[model samples]
Target: MTIKPIIIIPDPLLRQVSKPVERVDSDLTHLIDDMLDTMYDAPGIGLAAVQVAVPRRLLVIDVSKEGEDKQPLVFINPEIIRSSEDRSVYEEGCLSIPDYYAEVERPATVTVKHLDRLGKEQLTEADGLLATCLQHEIDHLNGVLFIDHISRLKREMVIKKFSKAAKSKVTV
Candidate 1:
């Protein structure tokens, strides 16, 4: 597996809704592997295919702490099937939006259905950081961002800041 380049903020691709995977074929399996590699290299708990400019309903997450046995999970065409009414706020960050984080309120628990890496169907209930991570990555599949959960003023400010930073880097 190879680490792929992650798409950053202000990329229109990030705003595009990802298409569902038609089949769990070899290419899709390779994509899942590459996504895992990219997420681990990014040192992030979760990643979505859109972050890699693939625009497919694919995601990988590993919430294990350092030195612990890693438990990587791949979600293909995953969807939130249920969520608790209780809300919780977590300071959320995205791999595409580097060095930026803000508190975002969402359901505290969620039940999701998806295809595992081995092409097997799976369902799981998640809470805490896992729930936050799942919602954040699922937003990517729907062309949404955690920043979108924040106030409009803050969201635009972040977009502009990233935009300026991107411009400066390109100019250099």
Candidate 2:
């Protein structure tokens, strides 16, 4: 598997809705492998296909704690089937929006349906960090960012910061 370069914020592609994968073939499996590699390399808990400029409904996540064996998860064409009425807040960060973090509130529990890397249909019930990470990555698939959940002032500020950094050719 190869580590793909993650597309940063201010890239218009990040705002585009990802297309669904029609078939789960070797090529798609290979892409999943690359995504996992990229996510691990970024040392992030979750990553979406759009983040790597693939523009497909795919994501990889590993919410395992540091020093624990990594538990990698792959989601293709994932759909949130259920979400609890209860809410939880977490300080979330995204690889696309590097070095910036904000507290976002979402459902405390969620159940998602998706195709596994092996092409089998799967449903996952997640809570805590896993639930938050899943929701965040899925947002990328829908052309939404965590900042969208924050206040408009903060969102604009973040976009401005990233836009300026991009224009100045400075790493964010």
Best by lDDT: 2
Model 2 superposed RMSD (Cα): 2.1
Q: For each candidate, give its TM-score against the true structure.
A: 0.96, 0.97
Sequence-dependent TM-score of model 1: 0.96
Model 1 misplaced regions, further than 4 Å: none
Report lDDT (CA) for all predictions.
Answer: 0.94, 0.95
Cα-lDDT of candidate 1:
0.94
Instruction: State how far residue 166 of model 2 sits from its true place (Å).
Output: 0.9
Query: lDDT score of model 2?
Result: 0.95
lDDT (tens digit, per residue) of candidate 2 on 1-172: 8999999989999999999999999999899889899999988999999999999999999998999998999999999999999999999999999999999999999999999998799999999999999999999999999999999999999999999989999656
What number of clashing residue pairs does each candidate have, in the order they appear?
Answer: 0, 0
- Kindly list the per-residue Cα lDDT of model 1 for residues 1-172, writing each as its tens digit: 8999998999999999999998999999888888998999998999999999999999999999999999998999999999999999999999999999999999999999999988789998999989989999999999999999999999999999999988888953
